[model samples]
Target chain A: MGHVVIDVMPKTEILDPQGQAIAGALPRLGIDQFADVRQGKRFVLAVDGDVTQEHLAQARAAAEKMLSNPVIEDVVSVRVLEADGR
Target chain B: MGHVVIDVMPKTEILDPQGQAIAGALPRLGIDQFADVRQGKRFVLAVDGDVTQEHLAQARAAAEKMLSNPVIEDVVSVRVLEADGR
Candidate 1:
């Protein structure tokens, strides 16, 4: 089966409490290398055959209409998930 | 600033209600092309300097120790986010 990957991230101006909580806990884990953390959603949509332009268009439409909330989130990426899992 | 990306997904054997719900909803959106839907997480960790081997290692460590619940989820990918935002 072919798969399409869609990524959704909270808008830059939005407050991400989950990300903040993770960042706050990192130091306690003795991992001070990172300055910030942003949490987002990743979706894999599987299709019956090889991914085609039409599938991509549908995935894009789905990403916008169903996968993300436009007011608070941005559909950061919409692409095919390569066979080797890029 | 540089960034590292981490992806976490529920183990294949685990039942993903969210994914199932999404799959069930797709047809309702008139997006019946997709056969399955699996939802996961994407995390972007920001750092102040250039991304290095050490940072990658730390990201791997964090992904295992904190970002994912070993009992249910798997850390599928831990890599630099790249300058081009790949």
Candidate 2:
């Protein structure tokens, strides 16, 4: 089985309210000196197959179309989490 | 400055509707090899300090207290994103 993880982050130009909220909350909780905080999404996928190039391609397609928004967010990368199903 | 990322995911016993929703949607988009999928949150923090052990400790403290819900989610890890302001 192939396992993959996709990281999706908002574009730098985009205003991320969720990120802002976290950034604002951090200092209040005593983690001072943080400049900016960006929040994103991570998806872990478990597929019962080998880690072939075709598998990677399909994963990319699915991530681009569904996991992230193209307008304001970017699918930073797709990483192979595991190959031996561990 | 030190940069850190925290990954938070639902506990194995917890019901993750978000992950199920994505797994269900993938087949509709034609990538049917995926069996199960788990969704998580990634926080990218840009802290204005060095990447010392103390920095990591504070980051972990902040993450555990705010970024994750101890009841149903777990803070999988705290990773350093960068150093030397890059």
Candidate 3:
């Protein structure tokens, strides 16, 4: 078994309305020092079978294809936690 | 400076279409062993000023207020890293 965490975010040059709204609300919520907020999506996957390099590669491809909009999003970050090897 | 990581997830009882779709598509993408995928939100904040309990409290409040949907989401987890304290 293994756990994979993926983060998807809009490109830096693009305008993110969700992020803008959150950034605007930060000060009112008492976090005045926060200069910006970039909204993103996170996915946590629980694998039931063997964890292998091929599995990780497949997971990454799956994320790129359906989990995020690659056109607007510039970065896709993945972290593997609690894998069978370690 | 400090870094804060927040994870927000939908309540277990609620139906997560996004998660469902991803889970369904996993096998076709070659991640056949993934039993499920839970969609969530992650925010990484870089604090420029003092690192204090009050600052952490304020950041949490900000996340709850604008970054997460408290009504549908049951979990909000925060982790502080690279704080000035240590």
Candidate 4:
């Protein structure tokens, strides 16, 4: 079986409160010399066979409708990730 | 100048409650024909200039110490993602 990966990130133009929160915490935790930190979500879906264009489209649709909010999230990337079992 | 991507994923051996929840909800939302769904976190860090090996090490350390819990997490990947601004 193959896998499909969905990566969702907030739009740079939009205000990223969650990312800002993390950024605020980083320095307090001793991680200085850091720059902008943007947080996002990743989903890996295992399909029962080789990943196809149809599967990729489905994953993209799922990411848009189910995983991410359109207004705040600007970037969403979809791809196939092969498992180590093979 | 560059970006470091830290991807944290729950250990495959450990129970993934969050992913299970999503898998259970997908069919209800009419998103059938899906397979295993594993959820993770993605952090994109913007650095001032070109990425170096030292930066990658720092990112890895930050990911292990703060971004992910080693007990339950299996995979944490770090890399440099160049920004489009340059």
Candidate 5:
């Protein structure tokens, strides 16, 4: 079996309160190396066979249409998952 | 100038209701190539300078200690964002 990975992130212009909360809390954790934080969603879709080009297309469509809200989120990426599970 | 990407996913044995919902809805959209779906979180931490080994270490620490709940989730990856934005 194969899997397709889809990444969805808030649009740059959108306000990400979750990310802001993380950024605010990081300093308390004594990890102040980060300047900003953005939190998003990742999804893996399992297929019955190797992830073909058609699977990618369906994943992209699903990402744009169902997985993310286009008005506030962007479908950042849609690709086949690597064998090593990257 | 660079960013570290962290990926967190629900443990394999855990129940992912959100992913289940998505998987249940896919066939409604006439995209039934997928058999299962798993959902997770992706975080981007923007840094002031290059993403060094120190930054990766810190990011990994943050990912484990703050970004994910060890009981229910796993920090699947912590790496520097690619220049091409992959």
Candidate 6:
């Protein structure tokens, strides 16, 4: 099995009100130095395959279809972790 | 320089309203089979150093202090990437 890590973020052109709200709340939360905070989503999944190029492609497509909103968000990165063969 | 990827997620014991809201909205958004969706945050930062074990530790601490809420969230993972030495 392989582990896939997907990072999704709002498109830069889209207005992220959620992120803005979080940024506004940060100082009060005692995290003052951060001038801004953009909220996003992270998914870690175990796929039934080895970490190959094709597996990565399939995982990316799965993320695009189910895990992220293409209209407002982008897949920032995809990482596949493989186990050493015995 | 190195790139540090931080994945932050709510503690399993805590209720993630945002994630629940997203999960509730998914079917209407055309993603139907997903029974749940847990939302989290991902941060990618460029640090000026080699990807040493020390760098990873420091990055994890920084993420805990500034980027994540230790009370309700945890730093799931930290990965440091280094460029080829020139």
Runs off by more than 4 Å, candidate 3: A82-86, B1-3, B49-53, B80-86
lDDT per residue (tens digit) for residues B1-86 in model 4:
67888888888888888888888888876776578898998888777888788778777777887788899884456876634311
What lDDT tens digits, residue by residue, belong to model 6 across residues A1-86? 55656678788788877667755665564544433445577865544555567656755765788778999988877665324200
Candidate 2 chain A: 10-residue stretch with minimal lDDT? A77-86
List of clashing residue pairs for candidate 3: none
Task: Summing lDDT over every window of 10 consecutive residues in candidate 1 chain B, give the lowest-scoring window.
Answer: B77-86
- CAPRI quality of model 4: medium
lDDT (Cα atoms) of all candidates against the true structure: 0.90, 0.81, 0.69, 0.77, 0.92, 0.63
Expressed as tens digits, the lDDT of each residue in A1-86 for candidate 2 is 66777778999899999999988898888987668889898888887875667777888998899999999888876768743211
**Relative to the unseen true structure, what is the C-alpha lDDT of residue B14 in candidate 3, on a scale of 0 to 100?**
85
Return the top candidate by TM-score.
5
lDDT of 4 at A38: 86
**Model 1, range A1-86, lDDT digits (tens) per residue?**
89998889899899999999999998888899999999999998999989999999999999999999999999888888865453
lDDT of 3 by residue, A1-86 (tens): 67777777787788888777777777765578666666678787777665567657766777788787888974356657533211
Error of 2 at B15 (Å): 1.0
- Worst ten in a row by lDDT for model 1 chain A: A77-86
TM-score of chain A taken by itself, candidate 2: 0.86
Q: Which stretches of candidate 6 lie over 4 Å from their true place?
A: A1-5, A10-40, A43-73, A78-86, B81-86
Query: Candidate 3's error at B65, in angstroms?
Result: 2.9
Q: What is the lDDT of candidate 1?
A: 0.90
Q: Which candidate number would show the highest DockQ if scored against the true structure?
A: 5
Query: Would you list the rank order by DockQ, best first?
Result: 5, 1, 2, 4, 3, 6
Q: Report how far residue B72 has shifted in candidate 3, in Å.
A: 2.3
Compared to the true structure, candidate 5 yields what TM-score? 0.97
Candidate 5 regions with alpha-carbon error over 4 angstroms: none
lDDT by residue (tens digit), candidate 2, B1-86: 66777778889899999999999889889998788889988888887765667777877898899999999988877767633211
- Number of the candidate with higher DockQ, 2 or 4: 2
